[model samples]
Target: MVQSNHETIRMNPNIQEKPETLTKLFIRKFKKNKLAVLGAVVLLIIILSALLAPWIAPCNPGQTNLANKLAPPGADHWLGTDRFGRDVFSRLLYGGRISLLVGFGSVAGALVIGTTIGAVAGYCGGIIDAILMRFVDIVISIPSIFLLITIVAIFQPGVEKLIFILAITSWTTTARIVRGEFLSLRTREFVLASKTIGTRPSKIIFSHILPNAMGPIIVTATLLIGTVILTEAALSYLGLGVQPPTPSWGNMLEDAQNFTVLLKAPWYPAFPGLMILITVLCFNFVGDGLRDALDPKGNL
Candidate 1:
């Protein structure tokens, strides 16, 4: 027996090794995707820079000097001066704070509202489901951009208002995704067992089915953040986003829209525009990685 065991160990050194935890497995798989790892690193740096903007930014984002306006990139201003002569680099860092805030804040609200509505509708499976699903369908029929534009046009745009508007408008998609997941998961053996054992409906919905459904939710939320940032940018470009003196990536692009400035300093628009592109792409890469990592079949 000892000889046989020794042979097995020699053949498979990992025979007695403990299995990798889900988190470790996920991290390992995520790291294997070079683009995802790169995106994660770059995004982390951007986030940290934005969060630490007050301490690290060399100059105030709102301070302006007409004499230095439109200066090209130099030692004093890394990305050059905007039309207002604000340090482009400092504004970029501060802008990231607002953009990320809106992105994450809106997505969080959407997730909560959408998940709750979808869970109730899908788990109940009758009139409640019909009513809720119909509402979602109605909301879906309306163009989200038009709805957003009209709402912003009606109410003066601020960071908080924009986040709120984006959340309410965007929740339908999340609702549908969550509802589909719930519908599929509600009939599973584990759920049936829970029901049979007298688990509270709320407990079963929240604890049992929700955990299983979280993989899709997480991926969706990640993608939605990028989309929200883009939306905020568009609104700001239209002159209804974060107002003057308050720097946002969106309004930065708006500032760069002057015909003379665009011709004089292409870097003006390019800076914020590039930030948006990189941020969205990084988010997409990370989302793709998470989707793959979360798939049980992929792990196998």
Candidate 2:
């Protein structure tokens, strides 16, 4: 027995036998996708610009300069002045802060609520699962955009309100995804072993099962951020979101609705629209990359 153990240790070098951590493995796999890497870079730049808006923005995003109203891109006013003569570039930077904040906040709220409900329903099974899934079905039946519009119209439109509405509406999908994951994971050997060893149900569900299920949850959350941003933009475009002087990309696009501005000053709307497109695309790319990286069958 001692010789067998010695032989095994000798055959498997200590350095080579060390297990790779999930984070490191994930990073390695993620780096193999070029588009995802590019997306990550662009996302980092956008986030940094939004976070540093106060210092980086040339002029006050809210301040108006009648003299410079409708000015095209120039040395003094990069990306030009808006109809109100506010710096387009400054507003763009400041606008990013609000857009990103709403997206992140809404998705985070949804993830928490969805994960908890999904875990309970899936782990408990039977009547609980049926009720929870039925509720999910009802919510899914409603047209989310219509619900959002009605809710926003009934209540005041503000950042906090928008985030709350989005969270309430968006969690259904996440719940479904997490429930499916839990249904499968609960039957796995590790989970069964934990239960057999007298681990508390709560501990087993959260500590063991949730971590294993996070691969899909994380990917879904990343994609959901893009979706929330688009929804916020749509609401703002309809004059029901973020309100003027707050300067989200959506409200900023409202200026383009004017035929005169659209004809004469194309740059006024172009920058914000481009930013929104790029932001959404980057998120999607990152999510796709994450899906591939996290999939067991994907190329390592």
Q: Which candidate number would show the highest TM-score if scored against the true structure?
A: 1
Q: For candidate 1, list the clashing residue pairs, or say none.
A: none
Q: Which lDDT values do the candidates have, in the order given?
A: 0.93, 0.93
* Residue ranges of candidate 2 with Cα displaced over 4 Å: 1-19
Worst 10 residues of 1 by lDDT: 1-10
Candidate 2 lowest-lDDT run of ten? 1-10
Model 2 lDDT tens row, 105-151: 99999999999989999998999999999999999999999999999
Model 1 CA deviation exceeding 4 Å by range: 1-15
Q: Count the backbone clashes (under 3 Å) in each candidate.
A: 0, 0
Quote the positional error of residue 24 for candidate 1 in Å.
1.6
lDDT of 1: 0.93
